[model samples]
Target chain A: QQPVQSPQAVILREGEDAVINCSSSKALYSVHWYRQKHGEAPVFLMILLKGGEQKGHEKISASFNEKKQQSSLYLTASQLSYSGTYFCGTELIFGNEKLTFGTGTRLTIIP
Target chain B: DAGVTQSPTHLIKTRGQQVTLRCSPKSGHDTVSWYQQALGQGPQFIFQYYEEEERQRGNFPDRFSGHQFPNYSSELNVNALLLGDSALYLCASSRQQISGNTIYFGEGSWLTVV
Candidate 1:
């Protein structure tokens, strides 16, 4: 089954902060964060492997829960360039690299 | 490197027609995976090819098929397409590994079925 993402969409002003959450009923091996602009493929943001793992890039960071079935992406000091949809992909700890992505969170950063 | 490259960036076809989208994996990569994304949803995995063979598949129908060439390039073929088949077709490439690995994607082929 696909993972569930909270807050279908968010609108923010430049430098504001936002959090997007993803949860899966099944166990997850890894949680991958990606951002996709309009009419473009998703770009890798960061990946959290072990439980309680937290990773960051620039002002963006994400945390995987202790159960390994949940993740949250934190966007801080957001810029207008952050306008896009964010997706969290879940991977099995032991299997092929096929990823199941969440519904996605649409973030619009206004200047 | 060129990352990943796809052909026929945009195309329109009828409901009963067929279409072929191509992709070339990045250098030093031997695995290719295809995904389908609708207007607002996240990408849905279709299949993955490795060593010129289909090693894994998603819940997609048989009408959705693909092949990997000797040069590590791949083609996604949809036969007897339906209106619901209209979506952005994405091709991703990554190196094969025992555990999960990062995959890079092409720009994607946008398909419109009329």
Candidate 2:
């Protein structure tokens, strides 16, 4: 099943912060976050395993809550470079190589 | 190391025709998956292949098929395409693991079905 993302779109000024949430009904073993600029492929940001797992890349960080079947991506001190579509992919327990992605949240960071 | 690479950056096909898209996985990657992204939507998983055999698939119809070569490269073939088949086909590769590792995606092949 496709995950659900909140705040379909958002705009923020530089140095601001934003959070994107992804929730799935199925139990997730891992959650992957990625950002895609216009006309470009999605770039891997960070992967959050089950509970108690967190990963950060630069100003991007994410956490996975196994009990909630949800993940949240935190963008701290957002930069103009952060403007893009953010997607969260979830890995299910069935061991399928497929990663069901969320509808995506369009983020715009103004300079 | 080179990341995932896809071929035929853009393709145009008429309804009822067949089309094939290719992908080369990143170095040391042993698994390949295919996805379809409609305009303004996130990618939807099509299927995945490992060890030259299909291991898993999404809810996509059987018309969407794929193959993985010994080198870990893969191909997505769509038969009897419909106008709705027009979309960006993305190929992603990852390491086969029980934990489900992060998959790297290619730029994607834009297919237009007239």
CA displacement after TM-score superposition, residue A26 of candidate 2 (Å): 1.6
Alpha-carbon lDDT, every model: 0.91, 0.90
Model 2 residue runs over 4 Å out of place are: B97-100
Predicted candidate 2 versus true structure: per-residue lDDT over A6-103, tens digit per residue: 88999999999999999999888889899999878889898777764877888889888889999999999999999999999988863555798999
lDDT of 1 at B93: 90
Model 1's DockQ score: 0.69
Off by over 4 Å in 1: B97-100
Q: Judge candidate 1 at residue A33 and give its lDDT.
A: 89
Assess chain B of each prediction and give its TM-score: 0.96, 0.95
For each of the candidates, give the backbone clash count. Answer: 0, 0
